[model samples]
Every structure is written in structure tokens, then in C-alpha cells.
Target: MLDALGWGAVAAASLLVGAVLALLRTWRAGLIGGVLAFGAGALISSVSFELAQEGLRLGGPLPVAIGIAVGALAFFFANRAVDRIGGRKGGGAGGLPLAVGALLDGIPEQAVLGIGLASGEGVSVALLVAIFVSNLPESIGSASDMRANGKGRGVVLGLWAAVAVVCALATLGGYALASVAGGQVRAGIDAFAAGALLVMLIDSMVPEAHDKAGNRAGLVTVIGFAVAAALSNLT
Candidate 1:
């Protein structure tokens, strides 16, 4: 449990790191977009190579399919609702949606991390690096947008710090679940996370990257994918 909590905190620390970077400097749109694109690609690879593959191996197809469908729909509707509730306005503007989306993305990933820890197969370096790398651009972009919209540094930092804590708790929850749950349940959780992540990338990250980075975003995305794949293979 302690090990799981520590690893979870390590993964979640990127959120604070990214927030600090955003608050400390003014990042160019192109740079931010490029980073977002890269992160998206890495996350895609993580979902495919790590989450989905393990889910298939452990749970078979049906549970994985059901989990994916449910997860995707849940995130889609919830994200829309957040948008409808004025998540895109005022000083907080982009911060609200971004924070919610990040939470949606983070919880499942960290949960799976905890599961891995409890499984005794040890940690997957590929997954850890992917989660950490992907989280960075998300926080940076969100923080930058919030600052641009006149949100105070304290508010932005506080939001990310809170998110990190929640994510750590989520990892601990996954660790706890692992002791009582069977293979299918774990597989379902992994698939569910993959589904949410896929929707998030398509709905926000990819489009945002393209809008800001133009065609160059495509190349960076591919590069990120390649790097992540290499890591997955090597690790």
C-alpha cells in the first residue's frame, strides 16, 4: 500500500510540475500545441499497448468491450455537462473543464497503476512514463489558458494540487480493490480507462493540438507514438 501510494504520487506529481511551469512562464502557442500533440500520442500508445492489451489478456473480449463502451459514454456525457455548466467562462473559464477532464483521465490510469503494483508483476516503466509525460502538457495547457483568462496563480495551483491528491487516492483505491477482485474486474477497469482516454484525446487534445500547431502537430504526434512504442517494447 505504501509502495502503491508512493508510485501514485510520483505519477501525479507531473500535474503540479506542469502547473508550475505554466505559471512561471508564458509558453508560445506553437510550443504548447506541440507538447499536447506529443502527449496525446504517448497516451494513445499507452492505452493500446498497455491497458487494452492487458485487459484483453485478463478479461477476454466481452467484459473489455462493455467496459470500453460504458466508459466512453460516461466521459462524453459528463464532459458535455461540464461544458454546459459554464465551464468555459469567467476567470476560471478553461480551467474548470480542463481540471475535470484531467481528473477523468487521471483516475483510471492511476487505478490501473495501483493494480499493477498489487499484481506482483511489478511496475511497467512504459505505463509510468506515458502517464507522467501525458499529464505534463495537459496541466501546462490548462494552467496557461486559466492564466490567460485572468485566473490567479493560487487558484490554478490549488486546483492542480487537489487533483494530484485525488489521483493518489485513486491509486490507493485500485490497490485495495486488487486484493479482492478477480482478473475480469481488473481487466474491465483497464479497458474502461482506455476508453475514457481515447474519447478525451479525440474530443479535446487532438483538435486543440491541430488548431494550435497546424500540420506540424501530426509529425510530433507520430514521433511521440514511436517513442512510447519503443519504451513499451524495451520495458
Candidate 2:
């Protein structure tokens, strides 16, 4: 259980690091785009290796499929609600989607971490890096955009901090859930995270990165995938 919290904190801390970086320097659009693309690739690797495959190994296709469907639908509706609210709140800046994506991604990601801990097989370095690396660009881009849009530093930091806290706590929740869940349920949880992550990347992160970095984003994303895939092999 402590492992879950510790690992969750480690993963979530990247948001704070990104928030601090945003306050210190203005990141270029191209730079942020490359980071987002790379993070997107890393997330892909995590979904492929750490979540989907492991989920399949745990439970059959039925639960995984069901979980994925549920997860995708959940994200779709929730994201739509957030978009409506954001539209109504007129003063919002551009990076709100990135923040929302990060917040959504982190919960299941951290929960999977907890589930892994409960299984006693240790955590996946690839998944951990995916969560951590992806979080940095989201918080940095969002915080910077917020700061640029006349928001105070405190508000930006506080917002990210809240996200981080929520994600960290999810690890504990996952751990607790794992204690009671069957193999099928665990598999479903893993699939759920992957589904949510895939939708988030397609709906928000990928498009945003492509819009900012153009052709460069594609190469950077491939590189990120290769690197993360290599890390999974190494571990």
C-alpha cells in the first residue's frame, strides 16, 4: 500500500516540476508540442505493453473489451461536459484540454500502479515513465498558457497541485480495490486506463501536438515510442 502511494507521488510530482518550469521560463510552442508528442508516444507504449497486454494475460477478451468500451464512453461524456463548462467560462486559455487530459489520464494510470503493487509483481517502469513524462508537458503547457492569460502564478500552481494530489490518491484507491477485485476485474481496470488514455491522446493531446509542431511532431513521437519500448525491454 505504501508502495502505491510512494510511486503515485513520484509519478504525480512531475506536474509540480512542470508547473515550476512554466513559472521560470516561457516555453516555446514548438518545444511544448514536441514534448506533448513524445508524451503521446510514451503513453502508447504504456497502453500496449503495460496495460493491454498485461490485462489480456490476466483476463480473457470479454472483460477487456467491455472495460475499454466503458472507459471510452466515460471519457467521451466527461470530456464533453468539461468542454461545455469551459466554453461557458469565457476567460479560459488554450491549454485547458491538456490539463483535463492529464487529469483524466493520471487517475487510471496511478490506479494501475496500485493494482500492480497488489499483485506483487512490481510496477512497470515504462508505465511510470509514461505517466511522469506525459504529465510534465501538460502541466507546463497549461500553466504557462494560464499565466500568459493573466492568471496569477498561485492559481496555476494550485490547480496542478490539486490534479497531482487527486492522481496520487488514486493509487491508494486502486490498491484498496485490488484487494477485493478478481482477475477479471483487474484486467478490466487495466483496459479501462488504456481506453481512456487512447481517447485522450486522439481527442486532445495528439491533435494539439500536431497543430503546434507540424511534421516534427511525428518524428518526435516515433522516437518517444522507440525509447519507451526499449525501456520496457530493459526492465
Candidate 3:
């Protein structure tokens, strides 16, 4: 359990790191976009190779499929609702929504980290790397937006710090829940995380990266995917 907490905290710490970077520097949009594209690619590899494969192995196709569908639909609607409420801009005026979306994205991934710990597979280095890398761009972008909107540095940092803590707790929660969950339940949870991640990449990360980085984003994304995939295979 302590191990789970430690790893969880470590994974989430990137958010604070990214937030600090954003607060400290005015990042070029192209650079931020490249990072976002790379992170998105890593996440794509994680969902495909880590979550989906494991889900298929433990619970077969049907349950995992259902979980994926439900998770995708849930995130889609929730994201839309948040957008309507003020998240439409993705930054600046949409800081709250962006933060909320980051929470939504981070929670499940962190939970999956805890789940891996409980599964007796030890830590999944690839998943941790993927989550950490993916989180950086998000927090950076969101923090930059919040700053642009006239938010105090303290407020922005505090918000991401709080999110990191919550995500760490989520990892602990998933570890605890794993004690009572069977294979099918665990598989469903994994699939759910994957589905939510996929939707997030498609709906937000990819588009934003492309908008900012143009064609270069594609090559960077491929590089990210290859590197992550290699890591997954090696570990």
C-alpha cells in the first residue's frame, strides 16, 4: 500500500513540476504543442498495449468492450457539459474547465497505476512514464491558460497541487478496491481507463497539438509512440 502511494505520488508529481515550469517560463506555443503531441502518442501506446491488452486477457472481449463504450460515452458527455459551462476555449477563460478535464484524465490513469500495484505485477514503468509524460503538457497548458486569464500564480499552483494529491489518493483507492475485485471487475476498470484516455486524446490533445505545431506534430507523435512502445516491450 505504501508502495502504491509512493508510486502514485511520483506519477502525479509531474503535474506540479509542469505547473511550476509554466509559471516560470513563457513557453512557445509550438513547443507546447510538440510536447502535447508526444505525450498524446505515449498515452495512445499505453491505452493500446497496457490497458486494452490486459483487459482482453483478464475478461475477454465483451466486458472490456462494454466498459470501453461506457467510459468513452461518459467522458464525452461530461466533457461537453464542462465545455458548455465555460470550458469551450480550452484555456484562458476556460481555465476551470481545463483543470476539471485534467482531473478527469488524471484520476483514471492514476487508479490504473494502483491497480497494477495490487495485481502483483509490481510497477509498470511504461505506464508510469506514459502518465507522467502525458500529464506534463496538460498541466503546463492549463497553467499557462490560467495565468493568461489573470489568475494568481499561487492559485494556479495550489489547484494543480490539490489535483496531484487527489490523484494520489485515487491510486490508493484503486489499490484498496483491487483487494475486493475479481478479474472481470479489474479488467473492466482497465478498459474503462483506456476508453476515457482514447476519447481525451481524440477530443483534445491531438487537435490542440495539430493546431499549434502543424505537420511537425505528426512526426513527433510517431516518435513518441515508437519510444513508448519500445519501453512497453522492454519492460
Candidate 4:
């Protein structure tokens, strides 16, 4: 229970950082891109180095391959669904759907981190740090969208808090199951998460950053990835 709670708190802390970014207005496009890139790197590193390593340590190549495919497909389809629905406004309010979509998109990566942490001590702290870095861009985007749509600061913060709750619950659940699963199972799961993170990095973060801020933001995105890679190496 304590372990689960700890993971939940970590997840919430990640979301809270994102919330703070969202609530602040002076943050520039380059900074946001840098943050997103940082997150992208962290997500990639965690899945690739830590979680995937543990998963393979327990399972074999087959499970790892299957997990990667599964994770990739899940996020790919989810993204496609988002693109298809992008044209539609949400229940007389569009921002809500965007927030929900962003929140849901974060779940798989966080779950994988939770599972990694559950398996060992080093990974838990590492994932917390990684995810915290990743959540910054998300927070900025969410908060910016809300403010643009005329939502109050309270609404933005409240919505962020709600997302944090979900993140905590998801992490807790993943951590709980990590112990029952062997390395192969974990490896497979990590593969899937890795695929999902890759897709998100390519499909969302990079393009969005480029679209929003052009060349300057794009460079920061790479810097973000480099920082994350460095951190992964440190771990």
C-alpha cells in the first residue's frame, strides 16, 4: 500500500509540475518545446533503457516484440482517433476533449514507469524524475489552451488536478501488478510502452513544436531529448 501511494504521489507531482507550467503565461514557445523534448527523451529513455531492460531480463524476445507492437498500435490508433475527431467540437466546449485526450495519452507511459518502479528501487526514482520532465510541455499546452478558450485560472487548475488523480490511480495499479509478473511479462509491457512513446514523440511532440514555434522551438526539442538521454545514461 505504501508503495502504491508513493507511486501515486510521484505521478501527482508530475502532473502538478505540468499544472504550474500551464498556469504560467510568460513561458515562451521555445521553452515549451524544450520541455516537451525533455519529456520525449525521458519517456524514450525510461521505456528503452530501464523498463525494457527489466522486461527482457524476465521474459524473452517474443514477449518483448509483441509488447512493442501492442503499445505502438494502441497509441497509433488512439492518435488517429484524435485526428478524426479533431474537427468536431466537444459538447459546446472543445477544450475539455483536448484536455481529456492529453491526459489519456499520458497513461501508458506512466503505467510502464509504475511497473518499473514496483520491480525495483532505482527505477522508481528514475521514472519519477523522467516523467516529471516530460509532463512540463503537457502542462504548458493544457494551460495555454484553457486560457485561450477563456477558462478561468481555477478551471485550469481544477482540470489539471483531475488529471493528476487519474495519473496517480494508473501508477498505483501498475505498481501493484508488477510484482506478480515476471521479467518477460514486464519486458513485453515495456516494449509496448516504448512503441507508444515513440509514436507520441514523432506524431505529436515534434510536429506540434515545429508548428507552434518553428525553427527555434524545434532546436529546443532536440535539446530536451538530449537531456533526457543524458539522464537515462546516468541511471
Candidate 5:
């Protein structure tokens, strides 16, 4: 449990880094869009190679399918709700979707980390790097957006902090679940994260990137995907 908490915190600590960067810096539109595009690519790579593949291998198609459906629907509805809220507020909802995405996917991702630890793989440095690397642009883009929307530094920081803490605890939850959860349940959890992240990329990250960075976002996304895919297979 302690190990799970520690590792989870280390993984999610990037949220704080992003928050600080957004708070301190004035990001150019091109740069922030590029970062978001890169982030979308990284997440796509994660879904393809890490979560979906692992889920299929762990259990089978059914649980993975179900998990994916549930995750996608969950994110879609949640995003819609957030949009409505932001609409009522008369704007100021730029980075909120990613923050919601982090919260949604973070739990399952950290849980997978716990499962890995419990299975005695010690830790996959490749996985660690993937998680750490992928999280950076996510936080940076999200924080930057929130800041642009006139969100207070304290509010944005606190939100990310809360997300990090929740995800850290989810590591412990996953570790605990490993003792009792079957392969299918584990598979479901993995797919759930993948599914949620996939929807988030399509709905928010990709559009933001293209709108902000123009055609350059496409190549940047491919580069980010290639980099993350290489890292994913390194182990």
C-alpha cells in the first residue's frame, strides 16, 4: 500500500508541475496547442499499446468491450455537463475537460500501476516513464487553459492537487483489489482508462490542438505518438 501510494504520487506529481508552469508562464497559443496535440498523441499511444492491449491479454474481449463502453459514455456525459456549467458561467471553461479526464483516467491508470507492483514485476521503468512523460503536457495544457479562462491560481492548483491525491489513493485501491479481483475485473479497469482517455482525446485535446496550432498539430501528434509507442515497447 505504501509503495502504491508513493509511486502513484510520483506519477501524478506532474500535475503540480503543470499547474505551476501555467500559473507562472504566459503560454503562446501555438505552444500550448502543440503541447495539447502532443498530449493527445501520447494518450492515444497509451490506449493502444498499454491499456487496450493489456486488457485484451489479461482477460478477454467481453470485459474490455464493456469497460470501454462504460468509460466512453462516462466521459462523454461528464464533459457535456461540464460544458453546460461553463456555459452558464459565461465562459471560463477552457481546460476543465482535461482536468475531468485526468480524474477519470487517473484512477484506473494508477490502479494498473498497483496491479503491476502486486504481480511482482517490481516496476516497469518503461511504464513509469510513459506515465510520467504523458502526464506533463496534459497538466501543462490543462493548467494553461484554466489560467486563460481566468481561473484563480489557487483554484486550478487545488483541483490538480485533489486529482493527484485521488489517483494516489486509487493506486492503493488497485493494489488491494489485486488480491480479490479476477482477471476480467482487472481487464475491465484497464480498458476503462483506455476508453475514457480515447474519448477525451477525440472530444477535447485534438480539437484544441488543431484550432490553436493549425496543420502543424498533425505532425506534432504523430511525433508524440511515435515517441510514446517506442517507449511503450522498450520493455
Candidate 6:
């Protein structure tokens, strides 16, 4: 209801602000890296607690294990596509593919957050904050890639708006369903989100860090996970 709308607005606004900040020439790279780190933390926290616990609650041990495996596979293929496109020879037009994929990925994620937030105010707020914060890197990265591809500002904004609409619809639907079915249903949705996020973290985020920072990147990656885990426990 109103709560869901507020959370959605918060998520979208945070992402938009992050995108603007990320496009600034002087601070873009640093901000992107920092946001990526936060994204890592978010994926780790969501997977470890929300998703895993939800699986166990709804479908016992087997479903949880299966969900993890399936999630890993999903992440693997999605990144593979991104890598393939990214590796193509000069002027590969990164924006379209990324925008499309992001829209697809974002739908379920928003839904998970919407449902999770419905459970308890504190839990939902914390989850929403993590998701909102994590999305900054992605929004910024999208804007930068579009700019590099020579897309006009209007095009970039249009693409962003389109994806945002998809997310809003998906989240609204997920929230409605979760609200009807209550706890067990919410857990299932959380598991799906957790698994998907985990896949994205391992396949994309870690590799990007390694490419950027070389050997020492692993240290940063670990630090990111630790910070997120600690914060999740506090919640």
C-alpha cells in the first residue's frame, strides 16, 4: 500500500541521485567503486539472512540448497552475456543490452524488497536502505555507459525511466501477492531475490573488482562482505 509506494520511491530516488553523482567527471570512478562495494555488501547480507532463512522456513533444507544452486546458474549466464557483449570490438553499444538486462533483473528484486519490507518496519527499512544504496553503482554505471556510447541525455533518461517503470510494476505485483499469502510466501520471494543477488555479486561484482584492483582486490571484496555481514547482524 502506501508503505510499499514510499519504499519504492525511496529506492528510485536514491538510484537517481547516485546516477547524478556518478556522472560527475572528477568523482565518477571513485564513487562507482564505492557503490560497487556497497552492492557487494548488500548481496551478501540478503543471501545469508533473508533468502536462506526464508527457504528453510517455506520449503525446508532441500529447497534452500536447490535455490542456491539455481541462483548461481542464473548469475553465471547473465554475466556471461554481459561479458560477451562488453568484449566485442570497439563501439559495441553497451547501453541497450545493459538497460534491457537490468530491467529484467530489477523486477524480481524490487518485489523481494517490497515483500520483505512488509514483514516489519525495521526489517523492511533496513532492507530497503541496502537495496537503495546498492543500486547507486548500477544507475551511475548505466548513465556512464550510455554517455560513452554517444547517446544523448534524453535517450539516457528515457532508458532509465523505462527500466524504473518495469521495476515499479514488478514490485507492486510481488507485494500484493506476498501480502495475501503471508509468511511462507514472503520467505519464498526473499529466497529468489537472495539467490539472484548472490549470483550477480559473484559473477559480476567480484570480477570487476579484480580487473580494477588486481591482486589486492580480493581484500577489498572481503572487507565489503564483512562490513555488510556485521551490519546485517546489527539489524
Q: Which candidate should be chosen as best, given lDDT against the real structure? A: 5
Q: After superposition, how far is residue 194 of candidate 2 from its true place, in Å?
A: 1.3
Residue range 1-235, candidate 6, lDDT tens digits? 6777666666656555655664566344444455565556655665776568756876676655665566556656665676677578455544444344345446666776666556554334555565664566566655766676676777777767767767766666766766575555555555555666666665556555455446655555567667656555664
User: What's the distance in Å from true for residue 111, model 4?
Assistant: 4.0
lDDT of 3 by residue, 115-224 (tens): 77898978867667767777887788778767877889999999999999998988998898877877787778778877777887887778878988999999999888
lDDT of 2 by residue, 166-219 (tens): 999998998898878787987888788778878888988888889878999999
Which pairs clash inside model 6?
none
How many times do residue backbones clash in model 2?
0
The estimated TM-scores of all candidates read 0.93, 0.91, 0.89, 0.78, 0.97, 0.74
Q: What's the candidate order when arranged by decreasing TM-score? A: 5, 1, 2, 3, 4, 6
* Runs off by more than 4 Å, candidate 1: 87-95
lDDT (10s digit) by residue, model 4, range 78-193: 76665566546442232343344345545655566667667675354545566666666666665765576577988888888888878777777777787786666667766776
- lDDT value for model 3: 0.80
Candidate 4 residue runs with Cα over 4 Å from true position: 90-124, 149-155
Give the Cα lDDT of each candidate.
Answer: 0.84, 0.81, 0.80, 0.64, 0.88, 0.60
How much RMSD separates candidate 4 from the native structure? 3.5
Which has the better TM-score: candidate 1, or candidate 4? 1
Instruction: Give a tens-digit lDDT track for model 1, residues 1-235.
Output: 9999999999999999999999999989899899889988888888888779988998899878988897788779877876776544532346455566678778877888888789896887766777777788889888988888787999999999999999988899989988886879878887887888888888878888898899999999999888887887774
Evaluate model 2: give its TM-score.
Answer: 0.91
Q: In model 5, what is the error at residue 177, expressed in angstroms?
A: 0.7
Worst 10 residues of 5 by lDDT: 119-128
Q: What value does the lDDT take at residue 77 in candidate 2?
A: 79
Candidate 1 backbone collisions, by pair: none
Clash pairs detected, candidate 5: none
| Model 3 segments more than 4 A misplaced | 87-98
Q: Give per-candidate clash totals.
A: 0, 0, 0, 9, 0, 0
- Please tell me which predicted candidate would have the highest TM-score against the true structure: 5
- Which residue pairs clash within candidate 4? 39-134, 55-187, 58-183, 58-184, 59-183, 59-184, 67-192, 68-191, 68-192
